[model samples]
Target: MTVSRARLALGALILVAATAVLTYAATVNVYVQRLETRLDAFGEVADHPVFRRLLDVIGYVRRFYVEEVPLDQLLEGAVDGVLQSLDDPYTVYYDAEAYESFEISLTGEYEGIGVVVTTVDEYVVVQTPFPGSPGATTYPDNHDGVSPPGLRAGDRILEVDGVSVVGMPVERAASLIRGPRGTTVRLTVERPVEGAPPQVLYFTIRRQSIEIPTVQQADMVTPRIGYLWLTQFTPDTPGQVREALKRLRDQGARAIILDLRNNPGGDLSASVQVASQFVPAGPVVHVERRGGERETYSARGGGLGLPLVVLVNGGTASASEIVAGAIQDYGSGTLLGEQTFGKGSVQTVYTWEDRQGRAAVKVTTARYLTPKERSIHAVGLTPDVEVPGTPEQQGDPQRDPQLRRAIELLEQRLGG
Candidate 1:
């Protein structure tokens, strides 16, 4: 266990950080170590009653606890107790190893079964499997081993490799599912039915080097409409979009449909660069810090002015919302589909070390607004045209309600 000091600084409060792979970082043993020789490190605060009380509790636990408690366990408990006192979910800590895994997850590729997942209402649900990966039915493996029907949307993950993950955190569960290439992992899932009992399914999948492109799809949807499905705003995304657009233009596409559904934003810098590719020269987004300091990231000159339709949903958030919000503000595009996922706060990620090991934390550093100064922290962006989602839309692209509406709008614009 790689223990971490997730102690927070509120207006002011403090807490502890968590670790990875169901193996949460070092233990409360860290707290025990902190109080051992660092009591005087508190300076004048050591004389405070609250600090005195905490010292008393620590002393008693060290002296009378049955069967010798681990030194680092109580330290972790103190950190955890601090976490519960805070309200923001994004301001949590991660151990060094876990932090490494987190960085790997965002790069659009990894060694795993190649599926995107999320925890909704405590249920670990499969959002989708990367096409051509072992988790997707579209591709066959070279292993010549037993293969199960690929994963599907709404499949509730029950266990991983025989270990129950019923109550595990999303990141922990995901870590459990990912491993080295060519290795195999078993998954047990519950397939939900609309009006019938859910069916239990099992799969033994071989892990492979999974590459999830930031732009999942790019093609000509019609004689004049080019469609691009972006999964994230990465450093590589602007170039990818540039190429995709060039290809579509070669295919005689004059208009574009930019799909941003289910895009969890990444890299604030990348977001600005991406928006610059579409919107004309102007401020893309405005960010304000706690001290009232404000900064505006503007778009560069020379971008495509093609007729645009952006497909969004509850999963379109962060950097994606920034682009959509800007496009909507400038009347540069039509925002189609459902409302977006509201995540307007910016988090600053950093790392620190302790007597035990290193840890990382995501601290809420600033709040961002649209170009028109609309604060969308908890309130998401509403589309120009409202379209509700339907079941089984993932299996067939033509059946997607949002896409169908976008196509209709484009057809009308193109006079097709």
Candidate 2:
């Protein structure tokens, strides 16, 4: 009886072992099948000589490269190369960090020293500083005995954190200057003084969370004329504009001067919404796609019905052009200042998840036309009144001829 019980126990143990082995074999077979399927897909591409050559190079590098190369880095380089081959400046690939920064820009908020910069003669020069920002604040005398505390417009940046920025792109220099809130960035600046040698200055500015105001200045130019300087068209722009218009109307303004000078345009929806405030019910702009499909965007009626004049310049672009074109086409307002920047193409952003986090592609999807079907891709919109806003007259309201002209036009319309 004892022998028979021991035999039963051994038989049960053998059965369990066999089942475990069979399960392991099945799992290995499934994994191998998946790998083989992937190889088959690769094989289809390998039939092409170009792809086969690329595969050969990758294999050779994996086997005999002097230093170890990450697979992700190599793949990213390949993707960038493919996009670069297209040679479209507007179409670009954004890596993880750049993608994050791009997203922040759309929101009109960022952590930085609160200065706007542009590339001038291969130098990153300060355009302006936000009000009450670190860049706007005046500092005490520097170690070199320079007295100025705040960054000034037209100040050419020489270095950031001791790294020379000569010939660096403005975008790259701006990225270096931006950091976490409350941190400090050391700037070496060269200020060009008339009738004197260029002044070399140093400043340590603290970074902060900056909320960029789309409407820079809004006030009554005259008792009957309102002036609104729109810096950009962001998501918050339409609401801000509505409030400004209402306040100006309450102040007895019968006309408006919409300043779009130096306004590198942003959100398209914001532009349409702002245009709807002035333009009567009609098609504002037309979007033409690659396949010849066209769509028209119209104004949402019930505007202020006030006489309006739009101010534009060489810096006005993208959605700014859209707004100006619509107003001009509808005869809702008169455009004043030099021709616009002529960026009439629209870009659509596409994002995707990858093993190395998220990446983005900004591709020019369509070209926009004015309501009259005029293509302004390379040819900008000529103003009804051609007035030049020189660099010297930029910040000086008293000397700004463009603003003076806009006020003249508005006053004439108001019979003031």
Candidate 3:
């Protein structure tokens, strides 16, 4: 063969490849244009400034970037930026792995160290460790080291297995902490103390199947007065409440004390159902959406009609607020203890899958108002009788003034 013949074949190959590339680009352009046309039919979103800014960003990165970046990462960063610009903390973007783990968490069970955690600023802080879990048990005799074995409330988790988790999503940090039962995970935590230097603790905890209960405890605090402590709301909550009420009733109880202190809230539907068990059949909450659309979630079925006192604090949030707000508005229960945690925005979780994997977004689609038509977002519910105290003195009368006051009020109601 000749050099010219080889050169000609190479030129033809290059031409075909170039043609294929141009054709693919054209097809993508056509698809994007069609999408823009569709978007225009609804709200002229294609002409929006955000669309222009985003396209400019993509073009600049693709054409003039020095280092190569994966398309997925680049696109995901863009998606994250857009969501962040909404300036709403409730609206969040979760990647595939994080989203999968998040869905599991909603079921009220998982394989991990049993602790409720939340992100405060740049740290993932422990709300509380479940009773009887390793996180709750401190070393009886600390000859080796001290103050690090047992995780405490308000402890900021800085590292998981020595990898820094600071400034990351709560779900991401949680995923790092979770694993199959019998596996071990090391943690570096910063424990804050009042009027003293903070303590940094190290923990090597074995993972276990952690099942979080909706109703943490239910029993007769007095011979005829029942105390029900709820940790969170879930699908199983209403049933658990029913069972608890039955048990309390069988135990010969007439009055009740419902505790929502430190309850961080959960499923909205479950919250409404749980409210139904206490608030009687009436409007429990009103959801107000953009464009002035409103939805009323009413209590279903007959309530227990027992004289009630609902104990709440700053830890009480979201769905917990819904129940407390309704009970207060209907005069079905007297709210005591500290002010409630004001988290009244109703978030709607939307999940989708692409060629890459699954992703999800939790968007604040509406604001939830109490039955009395009060929005509690950041304003919290003021107790009928405000009493201030810490959770450290949970069961003691003198220590937990809130509990002491609740008892006093219930006694008065019973006495009357």
- Candidates in order have lDDT scores of 0.71, 0.71, 0.72
- The 10 consecutive residues of candidate 3 with the worst lDDT sum are 18-27
Off by over 4 Å in 2: 1-48, 57-68, 113-174, 181-208, 302-304, 390-396
Give the lowest summed-lDDT range of ten residues in model 1. 19-28
Q: In candidate 2, residue 260 scores what lDDT?
A: 82
Worst 10 residues of 2 by lDDT: 18-27
Candidate with top lDDT is 3
Q: Candidate 2 has what TM-score? A: 0.70
RMSD of each: 7.7, 14.0, 9.8
Look at candidate 3 and tell me the lDDT of residue 239. 90
* TM match of model 1 to true structure: 0.74
Pairs of residues at least 3 apart in sequence or in different chains that clash in candidate 2: 139-149
Q: What is the lDDT of candidate 2?
A: 0.71
Stretches off by above 4 angstroms in model 3 are 1-50, 63-66, 119-158, 183-205, 300-303, 390-401
lDDT of 3: 0.72
Error of 1 at 359 (Å): 2.0
TM-score of each: 0.74, 0.70, 0.77
lDDT by residue (1-416, candidate 2, tens digit) is: 25743443333222111111000001122234334544554445435676545555655665699998875566555555555455444555667876776666556689988776655555887755555568767462364443435766568899999999886544557789999999999998898777999888888888899887788888887788888888778778899999999999999989988988767677777888888998888787898888899988888877669888888876677788899999998888899888876778777765555566765566677889988999997678999989863433443357677787777777777783
Quote the lDDT for 180 in model 2.
Answer: 97
